[model samples]
Structure formats: C-alpha cells, structure tokens
Target: MAISIQIDRVSREYGPVKALDDVTLDIRAGEFFTLLGSSGCGKSSLLKLIGGFDRQTSGRVAFDGKDVGNLPANRRPVNTVFQSLALFPHMSVAQNVGYGLRLRGLSGSTLETRISGALDLVELSGFGQRDVNLLSGGQRQRVALARALVMEPGILLLDEPLTGLDERLRQQMRDEFGRLHKRTGATFILVTHNQDEALSLSDRMAVMHRGRIEQVDAPARFFEAPANAFVARFVGIDTLLRPERIVATGNHAEATIAGQTLPVRVEGPADLAASVVAIRPDRLFLAPQGMPPALTLMVVGTTFRGLHRDLKLAFSDGQTLVIAIEADADIGQLSAGQQVSVGLKPDAAVLISSAGLPPA
Candidate 1:
C-alpha cells in the first residue's frame, strides 16, 4: 500500500550553492506524482532526500507522519529505481532482481515467491532465467521495477529511467509503467524533465526551477493557467506579447498587434507595462476581419505540421506571430507574403503578469 509524504522546509546545500532551497510539498497516498523541470533544477535532489540516499541540510521529511531524515536507505520504507536500471549484466534477471533479498538474508521458497509475484506484476513472468543483457531496454526497465517492487515499499521512486531508452521503447515502457502503478497501488514519485511524460502519467505534477517549485497542479490546469511567464514558456507557450504593444482596459487589455486592437485578459497583477500576453499556437484560429475580434497579419512563412499548417506572421511593427490553421481550412491560393486575418474567441489569449516572470 501507498503512504503519504510530507517534506517541510527542505534544503540541501553544497557549500554556498543551494541545490534545494526551502522546498516543501505534500504527496498524497497512492497518488502518481511527478517532479518536472529542466536540467540543473533541484528535482533530483528532492528525490534523493525522499529516498534517504542523501541527508537534507535543513528541514524535515516524513513518511506517513513519521520523521525519516536520519533513517538510512535500508531503513526507509521506500525503494528507488535509478536511471541506469542498475541490474547486474552478468546475473540472470531473477538473480539481479533478488540481489536485495539475498543481502537481507532472505532465501529459499519465500524469497522466490516474492520475486515471482513482482515479475508478474511487471508482466515479466517466466523470464526469470533470461540474461539481463539479452532482454530489450523496456524489459530491463521492468526488471529494475520488479526489483524495487519486490521490496513492497510504500513509495516507489523512479529517476528518469526511460531517458536512456529509444523513443519507441520509451513509449512502451511508459505504458507498462502506468499499468504497474495501477497494479501495485503504490505511491509513485517520478522524476523527469520531459513535459509530455509528466503530464500524461502523473495525477498531479510540480514544475520546478532553480531549487524552487513554480507551480503544482493537474496537467490540464498547469497547461491552461500556468503560474507565471517562466512556467508558460517552459510549458511550450509560443507567443510572447511585449508590454509596449498592449494597453490595459478594465479586466482585459487592448493589444495593438498586426495593426489591429484585440482584447486579451491580463492575468496576475495590474501593471500594463510590466504584464505580458501569451496565446497558445493551437488556440489561434484563421478567421475573417468581421469576426468579434480580428487581426490581420502578413504571412512571412508557412510549414506543414501534420494536422495543421504553422503560419509565421508579422505585424506592421515587425513583431512576429504564429498561428495554426487546420489542414482542411480554405487556402486555395494561400502563400507566403499574403495578408490574412485571424481571430479568436475572448478566452483564447492569455495575459501573464511580468512580476512572476524571471528578470531579463
């Protein structure tokens, strides 16, 4: 079964440099939680703290309300699956997975039963005698997972194990990982830098930056309403609205882009000059000027993007904008350098506060 975790005011220091700075979080029982961020972020450091592989410089970490900061790795009710899988190539799959049990002096029928159950849970049953090197990348990952699961830890930690696998194998392992989580009902804390992987798998995710968490929410909420400009950009938001081209008008702002005034909802604080605008590329639709709100942009370039065409447009001020057009849209004579009007519904454009954005 899964157990709840509470990390309060945690910080890890390497000399003067802080890898984790005053970070705190509550991971729910049986929840599939993910720590997502770019490289150099303190996500892995936080994971290490939870696994008891490293000690926190300050603050406390608790499992099911019991403080575990001083506990050794073997004493904690948690097991970690490292990125390298850590399986012994010379050992058989069963032997590699049972290595931990043997270390604890467990053997004979009971030990074999636990290993078999774990293998079945990861759908690697009957592959006990197979060499670790002979199995595929996805299978090797499953073996690693089984090894961790055999311990029956309350929480299972995975540190970007799929990063080393190829794209196809990664997807396969991702599906299997989901299934394994459901099967075992263990609280899983996955550490990954891939946004899509985190969004697709986790019940909720925390986006981290420079040892601090920017936002924590469900995937849809995180994408729809990012906490700040940094989260917005990191989450793959395409358009960046300059404050100079916008004017605040009550709850919304009037953006003068492509020589047309458009309504944009300014998010966060009320400073027009310091606030910004962000519109997702997929949210913008091609429409005529007579629409409720419209902007005419000169098409600078176009690229086919499977289901849609990505049109690069420029305004009179030389500012560029990109919008997506459905493949079936009317474009009999459309070409670069052509002027086209595009409009969106009132809720389409997102205005972000400059206060939350990182300093230039």
Candidate 2:
C-alpha cells in the first residue's frame, strides 16, 4: 500500500526571497500528483522540501501521520529521479540498478534477484549486462526509473524528469511511466512546467504561482472551470475583455464593435459593476453574412498557421479578438481592413473577476 504525503502550511525562504508561501495540500495514496508552474514558481523548492533535500522555513511535512519535517533526504521514504539521469558510465546496467541494494549489504542471489526484478519491471529485463552508454535515451530513462523503484520507496518524486527527451520519446516515456505507476502502485509526485505533461500524466495537479498555490484539481475540472482570471489565462491562450464593454440587458450580454452588438453569455454578478469576460479563440464564430443586431467586427489581419489560420480582428470600439479557423476555410474573401461581424453563443463566454490585468 502507498503512504500519503501531507504538506501543511509549508513556507520556505532563501534569505530575502520567499520561495514558497503557506502551501498546504495532500497527496492521496497511489495518486499521481503534479506541481506545475513556470520557472521560479517554487515548484522545485516544494519538491525538495517533500524529499527532505531542503528544509522549510515554517510548517511541517508529514508522511503517514509522522512529522518528517526534519528528516534527512536519505532517511525519508522517498526517491527522486532528477532531470539528469545520473547513471554511472563505469558500471553495467545491473550494477547501476543494484548499487543501492549492494550498499545496504545485500549480496549473492538476493541482490541479483532484486536487480533482475526491477529491470523486468522497467521492461529492460534482458539488458542488465549491457553498457549504460549503449542504451537509447528512453532506455536510459527507464533505467533511472528502475534504479529508483528498486528501493521500493513509499513515494517517487520526479523533477522535470522528461525535460531532455525528444517529442516522440517523451510521449513514449510518458506512456511507460503511466504503466509503471499502475504496476508499482506507489504514490508519484511530479514537478514540471510543461502543461501538457502535467495534464496527461497527473491524476490531480496544483498550479503554483509566485510561491503560492493558485489552484489544485483534476486536469479536466481545472481546465473547464478555472478558479480565477490568472488561472484561466495561464492555462490556455485567450483574450480578456473589459467588464463595462459587456452591456447586460435581459438574459443576454452584448459587446458592440464596428456598429454591431455581439451577443455573449455571462453568469453570476448580474449586478456586476466591474467584470471581465474570457473567450477562447475557437468560441468565436465567423459567418458569411454579417449579423448587425448581434455583432460587428473588422478584420485587421490574418496569419496562416499550418492547420489553422489565426484571424485578428479589431472592433469599431478598438477592442481586439483572435479567432482560430480551419486553414482551408474560404478566408480569401477576408482581408486586412475588411468589415465583418463575429458571432458567439450567449452561453459560451466565461466571466471572471477583474481584480487583475486582462489576459496577455
């Protein structure tokens, strides 16, 4: 069975810089959790704290109800697969994988059995005697994973573990890791800045920003119902519109551009004095006939983007929106400075609080 890792109000500082601030979360047994953020968001620091590589300035880290806040890295029930594979070129695959067991004084058939089992688990069963240098990139990653799994730690912490692999190799390794997780049944904590990796690999994820957790939820829920404006804009590419520009009348809210009022959807704050609306590029529709009663927009520019063309429009009132359309769409008639109206489903707009800057 896997042990749960609990982080309670953990905060860390490096002299004058606050790396993490009052972060609290729980990783359920056998759960694949990811700490995702851009560079310098303190994800790596938090991972180190969990692994006991770094101490938190305040609060506690507990594993299975035991406060292991002051425990040393090697003494904790966790193993880390770092960005670098850190394999030994001087040793064969078997030796490298069995290094920990040998250090713990296991020898003879016991050590061989353990190493062989781990190798088999990682799908490198017959390659134990091969030189580490001769393996492919994906194979090396598997070897690293096998080395960590050999110890049977309560949890596995991976820090940017897939950063160096090529795209195809990364995908292959991700699938392998998923399969290994199910086989090992150990709690996995992954830290990465790559959004797609987090979405694809983690059962649940926490988005860290500027030393604090912005949001934590399952990948699908987090994407569909973002907590705030920052999360909405950060998770995907979007345009943020002004609150006042959205004139609410009856069940519909409309924004006028190029002498046309485009219908939009909004929820909550029916009496909102200041609100922002976020629209995904794909949500906006381009029509052959202009709907003057609903919307009006002028095509400022369009850029070809392989599978899709990016349409840039500027409203008469000076607001800009982007629409991503099929590359083969008959957009030849749409040119720079052309006048057209963009329509949207009244229920498609996502309203967010304007407590921060518009999406960039």
Candidate 3:
C-alpha cells in the first residue's frame, strides 16, 4: 500500500522567515527518495509538512493525489525515525515495538505476533526481553526501525537516522534500510545532509539549497549531467575550467584552454560566454609519449591517498586541477616542479554554465 506524494507549490513560513519557498515535487510510490542539503536548507521543514508535524502557510501537500494538509500527524499514515531515537528506556524491546499497535486496540496474541514479526524484520528476533538501555548503538537503531515498521506505515520518513553511528555501523544500517524497503514496499523518504548517504541509498535524490530544490534526478544523472554549477561541485566534479574559446556542433565541442584545444561533450548548444569546461578525474590520464598531449602542465604537488596518489597539476597561468593515478604506477621521474603531458578521454570534458554559482 505504498503511496505517491505530490507537493504542489508548498511554502512553509515561520513569522517572517520562509523555510520552504514555492517548492513543488512528486515522489512515486515505492520509490526511495532523498532530500539532500546542508543545515538551514529547509529539507527538514518540508519533511515536517509531509509528516503533518507542521503545516504550510501556502500550497498543498497530498498523498496519492488526495490533499491532506489539514490532517494531524497521528491521522496520517506516516511514520518517522528521528535522529534522537526516542526509544523508551523503561520498556523492553517487545513493549516498545508493540506500543503503537496496542494504542490502536491490538492486544494479546495479535500484539505478540506483530511484535515478533517486527523484531524479526529488523533481525532482532531473540532480543525481545532485553532492556532497551542495555542494547548497543546499532541494536538501538534496529529497535527504532522495528518500532516504526511494526505499524506497517505506507510512508517511512527517515530524518538523519544514522547521524551518530560509527562508520561500520552506519554502513551496516544503510544496507539494512535497502533490504527493508524491498521487504515492506513502502515509499521511503530520507532527509540527510551527508551526500554519501543520499547518493548510496536513494533511487533518485533532490539537492536543496536556500529553501529551494536545485536539482532532482537519479543519482547517476547528478554526476553525468548536473543541472548547474552548484550541482556539479556538490556531486564531486571539481575541475571547472573557463575555456577561452569553444567551437560547438551538436553534442560535440572543442574547448580551447591555456592554448590547448580539447574535445568536450555537451548536451545542447552551450552558451559560450556563460559556460565553463568541467573535467572529471576518471576521464583524465597521463598522455602517452608517442601521442600528441592535450595539455602539458607542471606537477605542483602530490598527496598520498592510500589506493591512489593525487597530483596537483597547474597551467602556465596558475590554474590548477587534481588528477589521481594508481599508487604503484610507474612515475619515471615525475615529481614536483616537473612538466607532465596530460590527455583527456573523448567527451570527458563537459561544458557547463558558470552563472552565480558557489565553489565546492
């Protein structure tokens, strides 16, 4: 019974400050969607509106095309797992999981069966009698999830649920979420400031900034075809070059930078005055000795990063870009202050508009 959500022209205002401004989005049923951004970006505000914890000053919030703006949190078929787990320390694992069900008139064998199923779903089947206070951090997280899932909510909202867990536990819980989503077939809406969490967990994600959605698409689209300069940097495309000249024809373009012309892949006719060339690290490599180099730049510095080494290459005009190579690759006298020939793969460089965009 997954529900599709439609947020039509939503705006949440707090006195004078607007938390969400004219935001509109549609989330498909059973889809794992994430709202990603830094703090004060209004992701949480929108979540509140959806969860019925807060109401919008303007616009509509609908579930399955039915407007539910007037519905209270308890009346709506939604469950939220907040950052602070808020599990009752006085209750046992079974008691905590069955609390909501019991309040809705479930009791005895039915309550027990529901509790057991929820615990089993979270992989905590045998720990029902254990005191919640005695559970480890990861176990506690599972308990919180089980509590939410026990009600069989159509929409599960995760509000930074993995915020304070250790790295190993975070990864473990992240996988668990994906598995549970499939098992329950609920529409999962996650709000996270961590890009890694959003990118890894979401089928599609929206990047929010300053109370607005900057871009919304599948995870790969954010990397392959970012809507603007802000999104390009957010998804880790760091080398944005202001090409001195660009010759465009269809999806292919030639961008001249530092007196070297390099092939660029473009989606459409690029605005030459407003666009910059984006160089993805995976598409850059050391030029072969026999082939013509795309650009010869000096190795300004190098840093060791375990599996690979990052070489900071600088052009004659002081523009710099970082490229990574395998740690054990042959360097043949490559060091700081030495010139190195670098080349770009076909369609590696992308022409993106640079208009009032922030640096990563």
Pitting candidate 2 against candidate 3, the one with the higher TM-score is 3
Off by over 4 Å in 2: 245-274, 288-294, 345-347, 355-360
Please list the residue runs of candidate 3 whose C-alpha ends up more than 4 Å from where it truly belongs after superposition.
267-269, 355-360
Compared with the true structure, what per-residue lDDT tens digits does model 2 show for residues 175-288? 887888898899999999999889998999999989999889999766455655677677874666664456777657765434554455554343344456666777778865
TM-scores of the candidates are 0.90, 0.88, 0.95
Candidate 3 contains a number of clashing pairs equal to 0
lDDT of 1 by residue, 48-122 (tens): 999999999999999999999889988888999998888888999999889888888999998899889888888
Local distance difference test values of all predictions, in order = 0.84, 0.82, 0.88
Candidate 3 global Cα RMSD: 1.9
Estimate the lDDT of model 1.
0.84
- What order do you get sorting by TM-score, best first? 3, 1, 2
2 versus 3: better lDDT goes to: 3
Candidate 3 lDDT tens digits, 1-360? 899999999998889898999999999999999999889999999999999999999999999999998899998999989889899989999999999999999999999999999999999998899999999999999999999999899899999999999999999999999999999999999999988889998999999988889889999888777776777887888878777789888878888888878888784348766787778877789998988888899988777889998788988777788788888877758888999999877667888777436442
If ranked by lDDT, best first, what sequence of candidates would result? 3, 1, 2
Steric clash pairs (candidate 3): none
Candidate 1 stretches greater than 4 Å from native:
103-105, 245-259, 289-293, 327-332, 355-360
